[model samples]
Target chain A: AQTVTQSQPEMSVQEAETVTLSCTYDTSESDYYLFWYKQPPSRQMILVIRQEAYKQQNATENRFSVNFQKAAKSFSLKISDSQLGDAAMYFCAYTPGGSQGNLIFGKGTKLSVKP
Target chain B: NAGVTQTPKFRILKIGQSMTLQCTQDMNHNYMYWYRQDPGMGLKLIYYSVGAGITDKGEVPNGYNVSRSTTEDFPLRLELAAPSQTSVYFCASSYRGSNTGELFFGEGSRLTVL
Candidate 1:
């Protein structure tokens, strides 16, 4: 069994600024995957980014990046130039390697982008 | 494209009532899943199916049933609904061995048990 933890229940960031949402997971598997998902007011779950534990180089998507610290079991999402559109409930998830298993998610952190 | 579709966008069920939440996908995805999201909690997996005729229980499967007779359709059944079961349900699908295993979700079905 694995568990994902998102300590921040809510976060506020000003437009054009940067914000980092922290996430931690307890996994005994050496190889796994980490993901960040966004659910806006519309309630649509959107994938933000993914990181593979084996890869030391963090994964990035445009202005979205992850600081994956494998040893410390931390994977935080960094959104550069935050916009109002980024306001949403963000979830951190974990899945094991080579398995089509269900994702284990944290409680979630609601992000608020200040105009 | 209708990636994932769920029926009964909103429903109010009385105690002990039963209903099935319909879900279907046109993307030909091999993996389908059912999840429930509470007021302030992360989505909890109810059930998952790998392909036609192959279904498995997930984190929280009590009080819910599901069937995958075909690859495209996966329906979740709530037997004897209770207030504890009131929540928003989501249907999601993804291609087997997806590059990043990203799930495409449906609009969601909000069920209220009173």
Candidate 2:
């Protein structure tokens, strides 16, 4: 069984600053996918970014990027120039290749942005 | 586009009451999943379906049931509600061939069992 862990239960970032949310997972599968999902107070889950284990290069999407260290089983999310809208609960998830889309998720990290 | 839609955005039920959570997707995805999110806890998979007429259990399937009658709809049923079942339920769908494993989630349905 694969499990994701988000050590930080809560995080705070100042507006226009950067914050990094840490995540780690335990999985034996060589081919897998890692994802970060954001849930706002509105309760809508939105995709933030994703990383493929086979790819050594990190994935970047606008202000959201991931520092994926496959050997360490660590996948951390970085938010650059954070805005108030970035305040939300972020979750790290995992899904092995050919698993048919079943995902294992971490507890979550609640982020708050100060103006 | 309305990616995924879950009905009865909010509902409260008495103990032992029976109800169903309706989920529908417009993306015609091949895989659909039901998950429950408790306070301070991440979502836990309740059930999943690969396609029409094929269902499977997930991490936490007890006290719940599901059916995939069509590629676009997957409904979850609670035969007897309990206080432990009080949580926000989410319905999600994804294309089987999506390499990134992205899932489109519906606006969750919040349920309370009193």
Candidate 2 clashing pairs? none
Error of 1 at A50 (Å): 0.5
Question: Which parts of model 1 have CA positions greater than 4 angstroms off?
Answer: B97-99
Could you give the CAPRI-style class of model 2? medium
Q: DockQ of each candidate's interface versus the true one? A: 0.56, 0.60
User: Chain A in model 2: its TM-score?
Assistant: 0.98
Candidate 1 scores an fnat of: 0.37
lDDT of each residue in A50-76, candidate 1, tens digit only? 898899999999999999999999999
For residues A1-115, what per-residue lDDT tens digits would candidate 2 score against the true structure?
Answer: 7899999999999999999999999999999999999999989889899898999999999999999999999999999999999999999999889777468889999999999
- Model 2: how far residue B103 lies from native, Å: 0.6
Q: Give the CA lDDT, 0 to 100, for residue B5 in model 2.
A: 96
iRMS per model in Å: 2.0, 1.8
